[model samples]
Target: MVRGKTEMKRIENTTSRQVTFSKRRGGLLKKAFELSVLCDAEVALIIFSSKGKLYEFSNSSINKTIERYQRSVNEMGIGQKTTSQDNLQHLKEEANYMSEKIELLEASKRRLLGDSLESYTIDELQEVENQLEQSLSKIRATKTQLFKERIRQLKEEEKILAIENAKLREKWDEMQSTQKEIVEVETELFIGLPQPRTTR
Candidate 1:
C-alpha cells in the first residue's frame, strides 16, 4: 500500500519524539557518509539530541576544515579592503602629481608675463633679452618704412607743385609782356605828336 505524506509538525508524545529523533539522526549521518564517499566531496555534519547528546561527522579533519572556512571568509573581506586601500593610494599619488604640474605651469605663466625674474639664470635672461631685441628691431624697421613712404609722397607732391608753379610763372610772364606791348602802343598812338608828316 502507498504511504500517506507525513505532516511536518512536532510529534506530541515524548516517547515518539525521542524515537523519531534517534532514527532521523542515524539516517542523516548515514547519508552524509554516503554522499562524501560517492561524490568524493568534503562533508561535515553536526547534531544535538533533545537530551543535549552530540553527534558529528566529517570527511576530513574537522578542525582543519573549520580553519580553512574561517580563512576563506577573512580573505574575502581583507581582499576587498586591500584593493580599496591600493586604489586610494594611487589616487592620492595622481592628485599630488597633478598639483605639482599645475604649480609649474603657473610659474611658467608668471615668467612669460614678466614676473619673478630675480631667480632666473643668465641664459634665461639672455633669451628674454633676445626676444625683446628682435621685437624692437621689427618695430624700428616698420617705422623706417613708414617714414620713407611719407617722404616719397612728400617729394611727389613737391614735384607736382613745382610743375604748377612753373606754369603759373609762364602765364604771369605772358600777361606782363602783353600789358607792356599794349601800353607802348597806346602811348605811341595817343601821346605822340604828328611827326609822321615830316617823315614824307
Candidate 2:
C-alpha cells in the first residue's frame, strides 16, 4: 500500500517530535554535502536544536559565505529602489499625457459649442463649421432611422388590429344568426302554428 502524506503540523508526542527533528536534521546535512560535491557549488547549512545546540555545514568558511550573502542582499535592495524610481517616472509621464489629452478635448468641446471663438483663426472657424455640419447630418440620419422603425411597428400593430376586428365581426354575425332562429321559434309558439318559410 502507498504511504499517506504526513500532516504538516507539530508532532504532539515529545519523544516522537525530538526523534523526527534529529532524523530530518541529519538528512538535511547529508543532502547539503552531496549537493555541494555534485554541483561543485558553494553550499551552506545551519541548524539550532530546541535546546540551543548549534550545528552547521559549509563548503567554504561559514562566516565568509554569510558576509557574501549579506552584500548580495544589499545590492538587490539598491536595484529594487532604482526600479521603483523608474516606475514612478513612467507613471508621472503617463499622467502628464492624459492631462494634456483632456485639455485638448475640452478645448475642442468649447469650440464646438461656440464658447471660445475669439482666439480662433478664419481657417479654424471654417473647420469647426464643417465639423458641425457633419455632426448635424449624422443626427438627422439617426432621427430618420428611428422614424422608419416607428412606422414599421405601427403598421404591424394595424395589421394585428384588423385581424382582431375581423374575428369579432365573425362572432357577431354568428350571434345574430342564432338570435334570428330563436325569434322565429318564439313567434311560431305565440301564433300556436308554424308560419310559412320566408326570406328574412
Note the residue pairs that clash in candidate 1.
Answer: none
**Model 2, residue 173: C-alpha shift (Å):** 1.3
lDDT of 1 by residue, 1-200 (tens): 99999799989999999988989999999999999999998788889887799999999988877886786589787774446776798699979999999999998678767899999999998987787788789999999999999999999999999999999999999999999998778443456575655654
Number of backbone collisions per candidate: 0, 0
Which prediction has the highest TM-score against the true structure? 2
Model 1: runs farther than 4 Å from truth?
A: 1-115, 186-200
Native-vs-model 1 lDDT? Answer: 0.88
Candidate 2: C-alpha RMSD to true structure equals 20.8
Once superposed on the true structure, which residue ranges of model 2 sit more than 4 Å away at CA? 1-82, 186-200
What TM-score quantifies how close candidate 2 is to the native fold? 0.53
lDDT of 2 by residue, 91-189 (tens): 999799999999999999999999979999999999999999999999999999999999999999999999999999999999999999987784432
Error of 2 at 12 (Å): 63
Lowest lDDT 10-mer window, candidate 2?
Answer: 186-195
**CA lDDT, every prediction?**
0.88, 0.92
